[model samples]
Target: MQSNAQTPDQYIEELPEDRKIAISNLRKVILENLPEGFQETMSYGMIGYVVPHSLYPSGYHCTPNLPLPFLSIASQKNFIAVYNMLVYSDPTINEWFVNEYTKYSKAKLDMGKSCIRFKKLDQIPFDLIGELASKVTVDEWINIYEAQLKR
Candidate 1:
């Protein structure tokens, strides 16, 4: 299940055994919770669940030309991570994410522009992760993305 992130794999190659497992676990959680059609792709050295342009038509992440994406996941040098731009943009959800993730993870959890990083799978709040993932449907994503692109 481990694939090197080094070159073409773009997703899970360079990761150690533990990291690979963690990433896969996280991916499963995301997939189970998300709406279908959000593709699994490699972007920015991590797993990115992309909103295809054919479906959205406006653009990925809703912009006509902005292809940044709507969600991202990764197995970094120190941790496994997840990123959801829609949630990231909202302060309410950001606080919720931090509060929820801290409950189970003893390791350091890194939060960035949109990414959430943790050292172990046990640290992630599976319930919260599912909740977040399920909330935004592909249609909602497209609308928001289009609006973002307008900006």
Candidate 2:
């Protein structure tokens, strides 16, 4: 569900007790592994990791005033969602993530284009998510985003 919380800490604090730990740990994993230059902030009501305007002034095409979003984690109604733009926009990364998911968790992959859904909190693979977060840098994400825009 979308949150009205202004900060990442606030967002986590608002979650139900059952979800608090999973979302918190996921946020921790992302913060620990996300590349330099990506800032953690509240974006689109989720805990977002974005390339700020100082790094890429053009901002997001859909919302030019906002920073360019690369990744986000949220507590959804039925599952926790991890949205990674790199996984959605880059076929190589998608293939790699899909291939590697099986090695990490016994749960079958439940995913949308960029949204990875984890229903069972205990089954979440924090290491795999961390590795995914580290797979792309801010500059690389900007380049990829620009390339897609040109298409």
Candidate 3:
């Protein structure tokens, strides 16, 4: 769940072999499709993709000391997790992801408001994950996050 690793590379390197592979694959897909401007860092003890402070100086708003987080992938004690703040914040994206995942995945969708959990690497819906990562740019995420603050 939480990683004390200072960097994403360190986090991955510290994982057990099997977990490293799964996290690495997931990280690859995320990086390949991630919208520009989101930086990868270690946050909340996990490998996180965030809208940097330079891009959104207000920081996380909830915790201004932290960067505005967008997504994260981690190897937990029991299973791996993919956390997507965009899906949690946007009902439309959440609905679409749920529907598409159920329709296409053989693996069960174990998810919360923002975290998707799975025991195996293949259980992750790579295509859907990539799409979700690509849907929102940094500027768009800032607008959305700021709008929510106003509400």
Report the number of the highest-lDDT candidate. 2
Which runs of model 2 end up more than 4 angstroms from their true locations?
Answer: none
lDDT of 2 by residue, 33-118 (tens): 99999999999999999999999999999999999999999999999999999999999999999999999999999999999999
lDDT (10s digit) by residue, model 3, range 71-146: 9988888888899998888888889898989865888789999999988766777777888899988999988878
Q: What is the C-alpha lDDT of each candidate?
A: 0.68, 0.95, 0.88
- Window of ten residues with lowest summed lDDT in model 2: 135-144
TM-score (all chains, Cα) for each model: 0.74, 0.98, 0.94
Question: Residue-wise lDDT of candidate 1 within 1-151, one digit each (tens)?
Answer: 2344643343655666776677677777887988877776665556777777667554543345634476777765666677888766656667876777767566666778687767656777766677678767777777665565577
Cα deviation of 53 in candidate 3 (Å)? 0.9
Q: In model 1, where do residues sit more than 4 Å from their true spots? A: 1-10, 60-68, 102-109, 149-151
Segments of candidate 3 deviating more than 4 angstroms: none
User: Which scores higher on TM-score, 2 or 3?
Assistant: 2
